[model samples]
Each structure stands twice: as structure tokens, then as C-alpha cells.
Target: MKPRDLFVLVGIIGIVLMMVVPIPTVMLDVLLVINISLALMILLVAMNTTDALQFSIFPSMLLITTLFRLALNVSTTRNILSKGEAGHVVETFGSFVAGDNLVVGFVVFLILVIVQFIVITKGSERVAEVAARFTLDAMPGKQMSIDADLNAGMINEQQARERRKKIENEADFYGAMDGASKFVKGDAIAGIVILIINLIGGLIIGMLFLNKSAAESAALFSKLTIGDGLVSQIPALLISTAAGLIVTRATSEGNLASDITGQILAYPKLLYVVAATVFVLGTFTPIGPTATYPLAIVLVISARRMQTNLSRKQAEEEQMEEEQQIEEVRSPESVISLLQIDPIEFEFGYGLIPLADTQQGGDLLDRIILIRRQCALELGIVVPVIRIRDNIQLKPNEYVIKIKGNTVAGGELLLNHYLAMSPGFDDDSVTGIETTEPAFGLPALWIDEATKERAELASYTVVDPPSVVATHLTEIIKKHSYELLGRQETKALVDNVRESYPALVDELIPSILSIGDIQKVLAKLLREKISVRDMVTILETLADYGTYTKDPDILTEYVRQALSRQITLQYSDRGDSLKVITVGPSLEKKIAEAVQQTEQGSYLALDPSSSQIIYHRLNEQVSKAIQTGQQPVILTSPTIRMYLRQLLERTMQDIPVLSYSELEPSVEIQSMGVVNL
Candidate 1:
């Protein structure tokens, strides 16, 4: 063990021994002096600590010191009653400090006890109790604030953990102080009891056993008892004062002495006023100028010096700040830093600032965090951190969402108005500006609050401005999610899968296919609005069919066929048959025959007139399915699904094209319409 730990163990053992074994007066005096020194050191350290938590061990120290003093008292009581002499240190206190008068010595001891037990210890205990209560009560709020800062990227995880640890330490320290104060109070009472017992026992022993007169017994015993009490109580008073200082200390950057000096001298005018008052009191009042005039002159000089120092400090701070700014401008890193870009950016004009400002009760940042988690759950991809800022180049009520430094979607919002969309019928009765919904292009209107209740009564869906922006951002992210899944994200997904399906991951990655190939397959799924959350099946299917073909499109078709159940459940309602649009036998045959294949890829080798005829027929079938309240799904053969999707991608952006193999066997399919040429 280290020397300090060994010393502490030995000291505790010695304290227990002092109560049982009698010691010589010389050794007692040494121990007595050490006790006084320890108390003084504790007081000085407590005074210099910047915060109570800095002296976290002080509560345990208080208990040890209090026990040490009591042990010393027990040893001295034994020596005085048995030998009529305790130690030279106690004798000196009784004679020199109390002027050799027993009554005076007893009175001084009483004063020390009252000051420590009544004023300092009692007050410290109350303050500690309240502090502990308040700290525990505020812990949850402090923890939440730390979490908010972490989410907002103000502090890293390590910094947040450190701050939370400090808060916990503060609470524990205050609670310990609360219990430790009682030790001081009990020590004071023990001192008083020990003194009385020594006096009575000393008198009885001296008169009855030693054949001494009553007066001599009383005199000798009184002096020793008073002296011993004084020695113990003085240190007790110092320790109690230290406890008060510790419990009452507020958090500050500097020590107690410096904090007091800096704050009090901050305003020189206050000192000037005090000096003037003192000067007037010395000149006009009955009090003479002998003492007051000199003190007033000293205060005036001190104030002038303080004012000069304050001015110099302010000038130095301003100069330092200016120099720092100039250095930052000349630094090469400042210009090079401009190349960094946020992966996602949300920019708004000045008028819509309140929608993104947390101070104004806006929850846009919080909503953005939820959006990221939602995407992770639904799309199986991690969205990048979005940087929100105000751009003066845009119009005052407009906002834009950018993905990888390019604008993908933009919209306008009215702060005091709500956007309302009709369920189905036209509502010309509502008075507002007609606009299209930014997320889906559905017809919508921006109406005032007065029309909100009326619009709801009219069966219109109403949404606030922030929600509108959030919804638009969500849709944009969902549509362009394929562009966001790079190789890094694909690696993360593989690592996650490795945790559960280690064998499957090991066989597929870097063996049959690389991370780049996996990313392409995942991106293809996302482009078709398919979720890659079912990674086990996708990886398993890829492992089975990956060696047959190196193309991502072909690999994705195999994965989709393996995930037929999930795809079927996604589009069909519960307990309802699947309604789909199909191509006629003649048109399907024509398209199947038009497919041309090469080593690079396959392409449509159909005539332009036949392509036009196919596009027009598909549009007519899609329109008929939508008019019948059916989702526009085109079911085709597996051989032509990719080619047909590529053919209709630009013309039918909202329609989902599926192959017959992509459907589950349990789901019943009903053909709603067919495209014939």
C-alpha cells in the first residue's frame, strides 16, 4: 500500500487504542499539538477550495478529526483524574490563555462551545440538508439538458459523461456533509460531558485517596478540567467553521479569497461612496477624525487603484480579442475549411426563422432527429446530420431541402396560416390561397386559424407550417434515399448483420461479392421504394445466386423474389385480394421479343411506333385502375420486369411495376384492367 493509505490505517488504529491505554503527559502534549495543526490545515484548505465538490473527502475527514479529538479528550481525562496532571499544553492554555483563573478559563471554553455547536455547526447542517435535497431534485432536468446538448452536437459523448459525473459527485458530497455535521454536534456534547466527569472524579480521588484538602482538590482539578476543555473546544471551533465554509461555498472559477476580492473591488464607485460617507462621519459627527480620517483616506486610495486596474484589464481583453480575430483571418486553415459541406442542409428565409429556432418554441430540430430514427426503422438506412441555416438569397417565406449540396425540394409556408387539403371533393367555400402540397402535389390551401375549425368540420386535413416543412423533408429523403447509401453505409449494414448472421456475412462479403456490389443491390431496392430491413433473406439469396451473375440488377431480382411475402404484405390490405393492371398476351409477346441482350446489359430494340403504342395503352390502363380506387400496380413476367420498368420509368413515375414471381403464393390476385395494342 502507499504511505498515505498506510498512515490512515495506522492513525485509525491509534485512535481506538487511545481510549484503552493511558499515555504519558509528554506524548499527550504532542498529540494535542498535532490535533490543533490538523484542524487549522483543514480550515485553510476548505477556505481555498473553489467548490464543495473539490473537497469531496472533507466529510470523511470531519468524522476522523472529530473522533481523534474525542480520543484525545478520553486520554486526557484519564491522566487528570488519576495523576492530577494532563499535559503542559492544557496547563498553558488554562494559565496563559485564560490568565490562570479557573472561572475565566471555564467561561472561555463555554463561549467556544456555543459558537461552534450553536452557530457554525447548526447552520452548516441546515445548508447541507437543503443543498442535498435541491441537487437530487434537479438531477433529472440537468441530465435532460446534457442529452439535449449531445443531440444538438454542442458536446461529445465523453464531455457529456464528464459533466454528468460531476453533477453526481456534487450531490453525493452534499449528502455526506449533511450526515457529517451531526458528528461535530455530538463531539461538542461529548467534550462538555468529559470535562464535568474529569472535574468531579479528580476532586473525589484527590480528597479521599490522596489525603488532600477540599480546597486544593478543587483548585487543581478545576484548572486541569478547564484547560483540557479549552484545548479541545478551540480545535472543534475551527473545524466547525471549516464545515460552514465548505457547505456554503458556491461554484466559482477562482478560490474563495480571490473571488471575494475580485467581485467586491469590481465596482470602484461603491468604494468611493463608502469613503465619502466615512469622511463625512469623521468631520460632521461627534466621532473624531483620528481613526476614521485615516481609514477614509486609505479607502480613497484603494478605490483609485482598483479603478485603474479595472480599466487596464478591460483594455487588455479587447486587445487580445482583436488580435485573435486577426490571426484567425490570416490562418490558412480558415480558407481551407470552406471546402467542407453538410450531407443534408435545411435552409429557410428570414421570415420563417421561428420555425427552426428553439428559443421560439420551435421543435424542428427535435422533429429532424425523429425523422432520422424513422428512416432507420422503415428504410434501414442512417440519415446524415442535417445542418439548418438561414439563407438571404431565398424569398421571405420559402425554405429548401438539399441533399449532398444540391436542392431537391423547396416550398413556401405562411407562419400564421394552416394548410388544409380536401378529402376528395372541391371546396371553393373556403377563402385562402390555393396551392399544391409540396410533398405529394395534392391540391391544398393556406387558410387562417379562423377557418381551421370550419375546414375540419368540412372534413379537410389541417397541418401547421413546421409540420408541412418536416413532411416535405421526410418525403424528399425517402425518394432520394438510394443516392444517400454509399459504400460506407453499406459496410455499416454488413457489420450490423455480422453480429447476428456471422456465417452468412462471412460467405457473402469479400468472397462472392464486394461491399460495392452489395451497395448497388441495396440502392436498387431503395430506388423501387423497397425496404432493405430484411437483410438476412437478402444476403442469403445473394449468396445462393451471386456466382451465376455479376449484375446488381439481376441480383436484386433474386433478392426480391426471396422477399415475396414482405412485398405482397406491403401493397395489399389485410384480408383483401390484390387488384393489379396487366398487359395483354399480344403486347406481352411483342415486348418479350423486343428485348435485346449483350455482355454489357440488355436494351429495348423495339420500333418507335410500337413503343408509343405501348406507352399510350399503359397510361390508359393506369388511369382506369386509379379511377376505380385501386393502387396502380403493373404485373408482368419476370423476364420483362426490368426492361419494362426502364421503359416506363420517365412516363409513369408514381406507378409501381411488379413481376409475377414477386407475389406470394398465398395472396390472391385480381386483374383490374389490361393494356392491349
Candidate 2:
């Protein structure tokens, strides 16, 4: 239950209890007892007492009726040696013995208050914790949500699969770590009991020095006053404060935050200080009882102000940090704007001017002697000219770039046909990725989501000589850098992306979990090209190194195909098995030349599952076997999954359409040591 509602319920119960019970002469005493009990319950909850039994009315009832009654009985009987009332003090106790319940009731009420407070706050901190958590999530304090509207079609197979993997991993961690900050123990009742014991014991001790007035002195022994003889026991008060502090901290350790100043918050020393300050100031200064009491109340309540200020400061800093990150995403092109520059006229020489001698002719060129470095991409980049503005150019290629409003126009003239590249921009100068900040936009290169992500990844790597992995990789694959790479280079590129970057490895894991689903997505979007065997390698890599959020079913289908492919290749290539012939491109031809770099004689991106094969050039016999329903593994230029599916579908109609199930499972791994994904 919420704290306020719980308080209201307790209040109503207190009223009913007071009215229901018949207390003619002892009504005031009974009311006070009920009030104490109500306060105890709230104290237990706010202090976060976790024990159900203690919180229930059973403990409260026992304390009020038993402990409170006994304490009150002893407390009301005083040693009245003061004002010559020694004789009167004796008469008061004697009257109490004559069965007068009014005096008896007063003593009971005080006892109940002390006992219940002790029981409730003894060792539980749940009350404090609930209050803290609910308070943090208070209204108008939550961060704005950015629920991205995902486009299934626009994402393509690679992105959706990767994003899902990362999200699922974070969700699992959050569910487990949610309880890390909760308090373990906070017992306010124990501190109260210690105080009560000290109270009762101190009176007994004081009775030795003072005669009939000892009882009065004990009741207010540690209490502050405005005159002499107020506290004859300084040592006793110090001990009581120290004991209360130690006990409170021990009990509240679990629920209370370490950041809280224990000495200031729950430490009993603070209460002692306030009481002492009041007594000393009241006695020395001209302060009245009324003013002194009010000051004490103010000091106690204002203790929490410092903590509030600290929390506010931390929140503000975090918000500022978030805004700074959004602002940092601004693009360089927009930051360096040129007033008037038309790219088209310069590239084609439309606004022609004959050059004196050979002044590079309208194009800026740089002959950069490349440095040998180990990283990723090593492409020639366009460097912008300072102050002169207009016309940004790259090395060797005389190109012109122009920006008029949103349109980006650029053309690099080649020996043959003119090459063209155009991408647009917006007011924020942000290229085109959706961000948490609506105030900022991205640059042109980042306009495409995939490219933007790749650019971020590139910042961490040193792209000098770049990895030789992709130098000759364009010819085999069909996308951006595909035309420039060969088969070997293609495999090398995949290996590097999968293994070198921890983030990339983590991102690929979820996609690999459901191998068949991912393959299908790849096939549909990427032109139907990859084989089941290749998909298996991707899946196995994910299982071994990536974080998989789904069940093992993701592994079954793909593992089967990979194993089947392994068996087929292994059996055909074995020495004793019937002669094997690899039709069309040989294994050497299929593997890219760039990837042939010696890594202990194994293929750079070779799936450990590779088997021996007797390669033969494509011949008429291979075509006849394919037509006659004899299955043979053929190696060729890499094609997208969708295109491969179409080619295989046509082949199935002509042949018997043998299932890949024939391959053996053991051939998948081949005992080669596992490599990092």
C-alpha cells in the first residue's frame, strides 16, 4: 500500500479503537496509548520493516496491553523529595495500589509507545525502500520514450536480425539486475527498546543518590532543560546515543543506501545534539520554551535538504551530457558551407577556360603516398579546400561537387564514361538517420542507415593499408564495394567483420540463431544466392561465440544442412571413394586470390568443415550429370540468395531434386580449433 493511504487507514482505526473502548476516567491515557500504536505502525512501514508478524496488530496489541501498562505503572510513581513533597510521593504510589486506574493508565500509555516503536524499527528496512523507489519514479520525472517505428521491408535481412540480437541480450540483463540496489535490513524497534531499557535502568541507578525525587529525575534524565540539576548524568546520555546509532545502522544496512550519510540520517547522535542544543541555548540565552521547541523541530525536519540538493545536481548533469551527445552528431559539410558552387559545369568543362600550361585543369588533385596500416577500408577520400570554398576534390580523379539547397550533385570524370554520385541533405544538416534528438540532423554519407552504422564502426579501426582482405573483393559480391572485390577477398572481408570487432560478433549472434529464417531473408533481399552449407558456418559461429536469446531450435535445421553438405563433399573427395570431379570453377578458382594469404596453409575464411576435393574444369559430363539427376557441388561466382534460389528451383524440375539430408553430420566441424566469430 502507498504510505499516505496506509496512514489514513491507521488514523481511522485509532479513532474507532478509542471510541469503542470504555475509558471514563482514563480516556486521555487510553487515547495517548492508541496514538502511540498508530505511530508505531507508520514507523514500521516508513522504516521498511519486512517482518509480517511484527507489522500485524498482534505485536502492537501485546506491547500496549503488557509492556506499556507495566512501564506506565512504574513511570507514574515518582521519588518526590523536591518542594518538600517526599511524603506526598509515597501517598501517590499508595493511592495507585488502592486500585485508582487513572494514574495506572497513564503509565501504560508511555510504555506502549516506547515498546511498539522499538519492535517496529528493530531490524526491517522494507518501509524505507518502498518509499524511495516510488519517489524516484514520481510523476513528470521520466525520460521521454523513443519507440522506433521499424520498417520490416526497409531493414533488409541483415539489420533486423542483428538489432533483435542486441536488444534481447540487454533485456535479460535488466531483469536479473533490477534488485541490486534494495536495502537488506533496518530495525527501528531495536533502537527504541534500547532507549527504553536505558530509561528504566537509569531511574533505578539515580534512586541511590537522590531519595524520593529519584523517579522524576530518571524520567527526564537525559532530557535537556533550561537550568542546573537538569542532567546529573552526562555519561549516560552519551552512551545511550552511541548505542542507538550502532544498533540503527546494523538493522537498516540492507534497505538504506550507502550514499546516505548514516551519521546524519539515522544516527542517534543527531537527536542528542538537537536536544542538547535546545537545553544549552534555552538556559544560556533568553529563548523561551516555545521558541526553543520550535527551533528543535525545524532543525530535525531540515536535515534532508542537503540530500535533495545533491540528487538534483546529479540529474541535471546527466541531462546535459545527453544533450551534448546529440549536438556532437552535426555534419562537417554543413559546417563548411560554400555560397555558390555548381558541380556539373566544372566536371564537363561547360564553363570552359583554357588552362595556362597544365594547372591541373579545373580539378584539385593530391598524390598521396599511402601509409601501410592495419585496419579496414583503404579508399581514396575527397579532402575539402580551406577558405577558398566551393569545389571539393579527391586524389588523381578530377571531380566536382556542388550543393544547392537539398540536392547533392557530384561527378568524377573517367577516361571513358563520366561516373556520377548524388546524395541529398536537409536543414539540420543531418544526412538521414532517425535519432533521439529531433533538433539535429545527420550528414549525406550517413543518410543511408546502413552506411551511417558502418561509419561509426570505422572510427574505432585504423583504416590505413586496410585489411588486404577486401583489396580485390568487389568483383564477387554485388553491392557498394562488391564490384571491386574477388571471391577470396570477399571471404576474407566476412571473416574480418565477423571476428575482429566484438560488437559485430555480438550483433550477428541473434541473426545466426534462426539460421534458416535468416538465410531466407538473405535470399529474398540479397538475390537468392547463398547455400545451406554456408549458412551453417554462420550459425555455428553464432552458437559458439555470440549471445543467443532464443531456443536451440534455431540451430537444428541449419546444422542438418551444413552436416549434409560436409558429408557429400567429404565422401566424393576421399581417395577410395569413386573419383570426384568439381565442375566449372575449381575450389582454388572459387576461393578469392586475395584470401589465399598463408595462415598455416588453411583458407583465410575457410569453415573448419572443409573437405578434400579433386577439382576439374567445367565440362559437358558435369552438365549431363546435373541434367540426369546426379547431384554435384558446383562452385561459381557469388550470387545473392534470391537469385540462387531461382537457379536451384529450375534445376530441381530437370533433376530428381535430391535432398541435402544425404550429407553426414560429423563433416561440419572436422575437429579444427574454433576461431573467434
Candidate 3:
């Protein structure tokens, strides 16, 4: 074992032995001195720690020290009652410290016990109990805050994990302290009991066994008992004080002394007022200049010195900050840094700043965080950190969502109004400014908060300014999520999957298909608004089909076929028939024949007239499906699904095109409309 480990083991064994074995007076004195020194050191360390976690081992230390002191009390009591002496340390405290007065020593010892037990120990125990309960109660909130920071891109995975661990550690520390405080409390009671036993037992032994007179026996026994009590109680008092200091200490940049000096004495005017008060009291109470004049002079000088130091520190800090700013501006690296772009950028005008600012009751940042988490869970993609800031160039209340420095969506909000959308029927009674919903371009009205109840009564969906922007951002992210899933993100997903499906990930990646191939396949799924959260299934499908073809589009079709049940469940309401728009067999055949396969991939080679006819027919069928309150879904043969989707993507981006093989066998499909060219 290492030296420290060996020393700790030996020390623990020796502490246990102290209670059972009889120690010589010299060794007993040395142990007593070590106990006092240890207590003093603990007190000093507790006072100097800025945060409780800094001394996380304090509870364990308290237990060990408390045990050690109890053992010492036992050994000292044995020596005093048997040999009429305990140790030099106890003897000295009995005679010199107590002024050779047994009554005086007993009173002082009793006072120390009372202070430690009633004041410091009791308060520390209560604080520890409350701290433990509060820490445990706040754990979930702290965890959520960490998750929010992680989702907001304010922190990364590693930092989030570290923060969570720290919070757990804090909870554990407070709980341990709560239990450890009992040790100090019990130690106090044990001290008083030990004192009484020693005094009573020593008297009986001195009078009967040693054949001494009552006065001599009383004097001798009282001195020894009081001395031993004082020796034990003094260290206990120090430790109790240490416990109080630790539990009561708040988080700070410095130790207790520095915090008090910097904060309490930071204001020199308070000192000036005290000096004036003292001067007035001295003048009115017939106090002489001999004492008050010098004290007042000292207070004034100290106040002036504190003011000078504060001013100097503030000036230095400002000058240093200014220099740093100038240096950054002059540095070439600062200019080069502007070339970098965030993956996502959310910019807003001055009027809408309150929507993103936490201080102004803006939860837009928090909302964005939830949006990212929702995307991750729903779409199975890690959305990048959204950098939110103000853009003065934009009009007030205008906000823009950007991906890769290009604006994808922008909208204006009336901060004091709610955006209300009719369920279906028009509600002209709710007078408001007519506007298009930024996410879907549906007709909506910006109505006053007073009309919110009326709008709700009219069966309209109502949302606040932040919710409006958040909805638009959420839709924009869903639409463009494929572009954000780069090769690195794909590898990260694979690495995560490897933990559960190691053999499958190994067989599919690098051997049959590379990371780029998987990225493309996953991106294709995301493009169609399909979640790849079931990575095990997706990878299993890829492993089965990947050896035959390396084409991502072909591979994506296989994976989609494998995920048919999930897709069907997503689009179909529970226990409801799947309503869909289907292409007529003639059009499907014509489109399938137009698919020309090349080494690069397959492409549609239909004539412009034929393509135009297909587009017109498909648009009409989609419109008809929407009119019947059915979601627009295009179903076609598996071979032509990709081509058909590519053809309709520009005009029918919102419509989902599924292949025949992508539907579950158990699902009942109801054809709403058919397209013919």
C-alpha cells in the first residue's frame, strides 16, 4: 500500500485501540495535544473554504474525529479514576487555565459544552437537515436546467454529464452532513456524562479506597474531573464551530474572511457614519479624548484607506478591460473569426428581444431548447446549437430563422397580441389584423389579449409571440433537418447504436457501407420526415440489403419498407382507415417506363408534356384529398415511388409519398382519389 493509505489504516486501528488499551501519561498528553491540533486545523479549513463541496469529505472527517475524541475521553477517564492523574495537558488546564480553582474550571467547561451543544451543534444540525431536504427536492429542477443548457448548445454532452454528476455529489454531501451532525450532538452529551461519572467515581475512590479526608478527596477529584472535561470539551467546541461554519457558508469567490472584508467593509460610508456616531457619543457622555479620540481617528483613517483601495481596484479593472478590447480588435485572429458561421442562427429585432431574454420573462431560449430536444426525439437527429441574437437592421418585431447563414423563414409578431387561427369556419366577430401563419401560411389574425377568450370560444388556436416564432422555427428545422445530419453526426449515431447492437453496426458500417453511405441513407429517411430513432431496426435492414447494393436511394427504400409499420402508425389515427391518393395504373406504368437507370443513379426521362400532365393530375387529386379533410398521401409502386416523389417534391413538399411496399399488411387503405395522365 502507499504511505498515505498505510498511515490512514494504522491511524484508524490506533483510534480503536485507544479506548481499550491503557496509555502512559506521556503518550496520553501527546494524543490530547494532537486531538486539539486536529480540531483547530479543521476549524481553520472550514472557515477558509469558499464552497461546501470544496470540503466534501468534512462529514467523514467529523465522524472520525468524534470517535477519536470519545476514545481519548475513555482513556483519560481510566487514568484519572485509577492513578489519580490523567496527563500533563489535563493537569495544566486544571491548574493554570482554570487558575487552580475547581469551581471556576467546572463553570468554564460547562459553558463551553453549552455553547457547542446548544448553539453551534444544534444550528448546524438544523441547517444540514434543511440543506439536505432542499438539495434533494431541487435535484430534478437542476437536472432539467442542465438538459436545457445542453439542448440550447450552451454546453456539450461532456459538460452536461459533469454538471449532473456535480449535482448528485452535492446532494450526497448534504445528506451525509445531515447524519454526521448527529455525531457531534452525541459527542456533546457523552462529554457531560463522562464528566459527571469521573467526578462522582473519583470522589468515592479518593475517600474510601485511598483513605483520604472528604475535603482533600473533593478537591483532588474535582480538579481532575474538571480538567479532563475542559480538555475534551474545548476540542469538541472547536469541531462544533467548524461544523456550523461549513453548513452556513454560502458560495463565494473567496473565503469567509475575504468575503466579509470585501462585502461588509466595501462601503466606507458606513464606517464614516459609525465614526461620526462614536464621536457624538464621546462628546455627549462625558467620555475623554484619551480613548474615543484615538479610536475615532483610527476609524476615519481606515475608511479613507478602504475608499482609496476600492477606487484603485475599480480603475484598474476598467483599464484592463479596455486594453483587452483594444487588443482583441487589433488582433488578426479576431477578424478571421468572423468567417465562421453557426449551424443555426436565430436573429430578432429590438422589440422582440423580450421574447428571448430570460430577465424580461422571455422563454424563447428555453422554448428553442425544448424544440431541439423534441426534434432529437421525434426526428432522431441532434439539432445544432441555435445562436440567438439581436439584429438592429431588421424592423422591430421581426425575427428570422437561418440555417448555415441563409434565411429559411422570417416573421413579424405583434408583441401585445395573440395569433389566432380559426379551426375551420371564419370568425369575423373577433376583429383583428389579418396575417398569414409563418409556419404553414394559413390565414391567421393578430388579436388583442382581451379577445383571447373570445377566440378560444370560437374554437380558434391561439398562441403568444414566442410560441409563434417557436412553431415557425420547429417547422423550418423539420423541413431542413436532413441538411444538418452530416457524416460526423451519422458516426455519432452509429457509435451510440454500437453500444446496443454492436455486431449489427460492425457488419453494416465500413464493411458493407461506409459512414457517408449511412449518412445519405439516414438523410434520405429524414428528408421524408421519417424518424430513424429505431436505429437497431434501420441498421438491421441495412445489414440485410447493403451487400447487394451500395446505392443510398435504393438502400433507403429497403429501410423504409422495413419501417413501414412505424410510418403507417405515424400517419394513421388509431383504429382509423388510411386514406390516400393513388396514381392510376396507366400513369404508374408510363412513369415506370420513363425511369432510365445510369451508373450514377436512376432519373425520370418522361417528356415535358407527359410530366406536366402527371403534375396537373396529381395536384388535382391532392386538392380533392385536402377538401375531404384527409392528409395528402401519394401511393405508387415500389419501383416508381422515388421518381414520383422527386417529381412532386417542389409542388407538393408537404405531401408524403409512400410506396406500396411501405404500408403494413394489416392496415386498411381507402383510396380517396386517383391521378391519371
Candidates' TM-scores? 0.57, 0.21, 0.58
Candidate 3 lDDT over 1-677, as tens digits, reads: 89999999999999999899999999999999999999999999999999999999999999999999999999999998899999889888888757757778888888889999999999999999999999999999999999999988999999999999999999999999999999999999999999889988998999888898888888887888888888888899999999999988888999999998988998998888888888887887888666687788889999999999989999999999999989998998889879998889999899998997789899988898899999999998889999999999999989898999999889999999999998999877887999999999999999998999999999999999888998899999999999899998988899999998788887887889899998999998999899989989998998899899999989999999999888989887762568888888899999889999999988889898988888888888888878888888888889899989888778787799998798888888888888876
C-alpha lDDT values of all predictions: 0.90, 0.33, 0.90
Put down candidate 2 lDDT per residue, 1-677, tens digits, no spaces.
99998996785565445433432324434433443454444443424432222223322332333333223222322222122121222233334332334345334434543443343322222333443344345412221111232442545556655555434433332222123111111122322343355445545545655552565654333221100111111111222222222223323443333425444464534655786699678767888667787777666556456446657877999999888756655645544455554311223232222111137342221111121111122221111221113333343333232222222232222222111112221333323323221011211221343343444443411111111112211111212221123334434434455665656444564454343433333232222222222433644544553354232222333343444544355444442232222222334333333243343332234333331122112234356555554443432223221122233443332211112253443333221111111
Candidate with better lDDT, 1 vs 3: 3
In candidate 2, clashing pairs total 60
Evaluate model 3: give its lDDT: 0.90
Name the lDDT value of residue 5 in candidate 1: 91
Q: For candidate 2, report its TM-score.
A: 0.21
Position 494, candidate 2: lDDT: 44
| Candidate 1 Cα errors over 4 Å, as ranges | 1-34, 49-89, 95-104, 107-194, 201-213, 239-343, 348-388, 395-399, 410-475, 484-523, 531-633, 643-654, 664-677
User: In model 2, which regions exceed 4 Å deviation?
Assistant: 1-677
Best-to-worst order by TM-score is 3, 1, 2
> Tens digits of per-residue lDDT for model 1 on 1-677?
99999999999999999999998999999999999999999999998999888789999999999999999999999888888899899888877756756778778888888888889888988998999999999999999999999998999999999999999998899889989999999998898898889888988999998789988998888888888998899899999999999988888999878998988778998988999999999999989899799999999999999989999999999999999989988999778767786778999999999988889988999999999999998888999888999999999999998988899899999999999998898666776889889999999999999999989988999999989998999999889999999999999999999999999999998899999999999998998889999888999999999989879988989998998888888887662568889877888788889988899977778898998999998988888888877888999889888888888878886688888899887788899888878
CA shift of 477, model 1, Å: 3.5
